[model samples]
Target: MLIALSFAVGGLLHHLGILRIDHLPPLHAHFRVPTFRLLPAAVFGLAAAWMLPGALARLRFGRAIALGYGTALAWTVLLAVSGDGLAAPFTHKEEYLAVLPAVGDDPSGWLAGFTEHLPGYPTHVRGHPPLPVLVVWALQALGLPGPLWAALLVVLVGCSAAVAITLTVRRLGGEDAARRALPYLALTPASVWIATSMDAFFAGVGAWGVALLVLGRKRWSRLLSGAGAGVLLGSLPYLSYGLVPYLLIPVVVAVMVRPSRLTVAAILAGAGSVTAAFAAGGFFWPDGVLATHAQWAADPGAARPYLYFLFANIAVLALVTGPAATAGLVGPIPARVRTVVAATLVAVAALDVSGVTRGEVERIWVPFAVWVSVAGGFAGGRAGGHAGDRRWLAAQVVTGLLLQGLVASPW
Candidate 1:
């Protein structure tokens, strides 16, 4: 009942919020009711997620990770078939192509891969860092062809993140929490965007990196996990400028979960070393930050008013999280990590309202959204049972499918 009311109120607010704003973009061109064409694919996503729990329970961790990857890939392929045909050619392949030469031309792989190679990187690649671009180059170098490989690269990223989320939850909250959280993480309406966006790769690496840090003190290989985590935590700053904010997760997880002093120090050292490496490569973090604004100059979405989109983005986030998790946002949560998590969400909200990331925040905010979705699992504790219903979960799946099937925004 509370979930239903929250969705109703959210819908009402979106409608009322848009009415007060003038010069709003046309929704019709972007969003429409799909005909029968894509319905099967939409239905498939919901069904697969619903049925996954039993299958996941039977598999060990290794198989479970593979299943997560294959499921997401299949979901992406299904979504593509439903909308743009199975090939779903990468729309932003140009960005990958533009940065490929920098990787190929550089003699010292580490130095050139870390630096942005200014005056050479077409403006399209300027605002970005080199990690993902290098990954694209690596894929091509390995003989993977065209946009198809890039598409697979993104799928791998999202799948890896999904597996990372499962492992992290199991480490911190126990298997029950891990089990409860997987469905929300895998099939939440955001999977639609996960299917197409490179941000998923960023989200995957950053997420696993943090997961390693948090698990530093767990029974398994504390030295190895902490060491790797430190490197990941440090390299995050170089991945994407916007991703800098997400560094808070590792910081908060470290504090709340409490790793050993050595683990924490290693994390700091890893970041410092990576920073030094990037400096030697001739690209400084400050320059990357400045380049972001220049890159946004060509972004059409940036033109939208923040006030209107702030509310709209929240609506999209609510849908992305789905009805059950959306309801969880309002409910009570475990206190130990609540303050930090809430603060993170509040910070993201403040950033959105500031107009810095005015539009397409639903996509840009992927890393933060993954954390924010944790609220749903926490809410389940407050409810004395799980917070989400399978039916509501299915409803969430439909919301995402409709977004792609109806609006077909190629972001």
Candidate 2:
């Protein structure tokens, strides 16, 4: 039924003229190299064999990491190689790719004049904050090549997010929750874009920052976690204007779960550091963030009739989240985590409806999507309890990947 539902959704998207056919470019032709196509399958087969012992029984943290990133890399690389073979940008990667060479040439000038560089409303460069550019610039400085570096950075950040999600679940629930959640994080339909966007890195920083704050039950840990969360959360608005709303999630978690004066103080201080730095650099948060909307409002995609893609993206988000986990969101859970999760969902839903994210939310809503997957751990049924349940999730991911690969839509 879920498979059919996914196909139906894809069919509907095709009918709507959203998905189109494309001729394979010379660069993407290498994916047709028969040997290259076989490699990902071989890698996955070996990983499943290695992880079978741990996955079926204890699901240890180390094995979970292996399963998560191993699966993530296999799936992501397969998608990338299949689509473009790492030669051309994958869906919206141009946004991040545009800024790197400029940043590499003059980091200070870029920082000071980033807002001024926005040629118009919805300029690709204005689509995200400057942090990703700095990170990519540093990678380029270390001799990594163009666009490939962007891809690698995104994959690394995404895999780290998987680890952070595991840790957060371990803290809130237990090993069982963490174990059940890892696979979902690893192979969600979102993986198609995880290596293509700076949003994945933003999701990682935000996930770990909040995870540390909520999971740190010890005093010293709380101090460090709080401070780290503050810095990341503080940096969120700088990452993207859309992310400013997410600051509420960590703030609520800190206040509700582990309210300590020192933790709060550290958070404030960590936030202050970025604030001070950006201020020193002449980019005030309000002024910079407010300027993003001009491009957003001006972008043709955002200017389209909202209802056309609004419901479609919502449907895609649900499918990408997997049917079981989507079902689980409304099911039972521990009160504390449930509250956090529910609040996060409300924020995400509000954003979805506001037309700010008119379309492409499967990639755009990644930061909130991780939390939704985590919250699914608390749902009524035992996660992955049914026999062949993992197969079902795998099928969901595979189906989505095929749809994405076949479609000409840009992420």
Candidate 3:
């Protein structure tokens, strides 16, 4: 109903010329006629949705991770191919690869002047910090140059976010909860965007950062985990300023785990080192944010109606998370996991009203979307048995396939 209302109201506003959504209302995509190419992904998704819930529950933790990650990778690739082929990652002129040549051999030099170059760079480059381009640059440096390799790299990292989310759930709610959530985590409508967007890359990084922090709260591994989380979290804002809201996730984890003072220091140290390195390279994070804001203000897309987007953004979120997550949001969530869910909702609400994120949140909010999808686990668990779980999982899979087949994403 929320999704329906967003589209109805948003479409009305767009038709009335009061809202300037460039593509579709609530999504930065257009309608497309799906071809025979979609059949393979559709078949695979249905099979996985039907089979994965039981398998994830019965398999050992290691095997479940393998199955979940492998299936997610295959699903994302198939969906990407079904919609736009392998070149989809670089097909858009505004993507990071188009701006890679500007960096040349001196990444440090590029980082130093990133803010100054914002006005002239393409849309994706201008909006983000230096990490996305640097990631592709690093891949190129490693002999994996060109769009094909970059696309594969993005898919590989993006799919791994499922593993991270599964681990976090296991840490917080126990193995059963993790297993219950694994299928939904592995099969999500967000995979439509995960196939080709840098936002998916950010989702993977942020998810792992939070996962490590949760997993690292033990006495023996606290320092190591905290430091690892710190580096990933620290690098997040550099990847995309919009990801700043994700910082709240770790705070939720810390409160739940109650880490010692030393662990806190380690997290701070890890994050601080990344900040220090960027500063040394002549890029201050705050100034970069200000510059990006100015660029965003100048972009014509900023003319989008905020009042409409406040609810429409959440509508896109519902589409990405699917019906199962919606059921979970209102269903009986476990006490331990409730805080994480609450934190995620609060973050999304904050982003929605901030006016910084007007639309296209389907992809931009992928990080939070993963956590929100965790609710599907509880929804499945309470739905009776494995059959109920499979039904919910299938719903999520169908949502992804339908979106991939029907929507032509700009990414």
RMSD of each: 5.0, 4.9, 1.5
Estimate TM-scores for all models.
Answer: 0.81, 0.82, 0.97
lDDT of 3: 0.86
What lDDT does the true structure give each of the candidates? 0.63, 0.64, 0.86
**Per-residue accuracy of model 3 over 214-243 as CA lDDT, tens digit each:** 875357698899989999999998898888
Query: Candidate 3 has what TM-score?
Result: 0.97
Clashing pairs in 2: 121-294, 121-295, 122-295
Worst 10 residues of 2 by lDDT: 22-31
Candidate 1 lDDT over 1-57, as tens digits, reads 433453354446446664222222222125556767677777777677567666665
Candidate that scores best on TM-score: 3
Order of all candidates by lDDT, from best down to worst? 3, 2, 1
How would you order the candidates by TM-score, starting with the best? 3, 2, 1
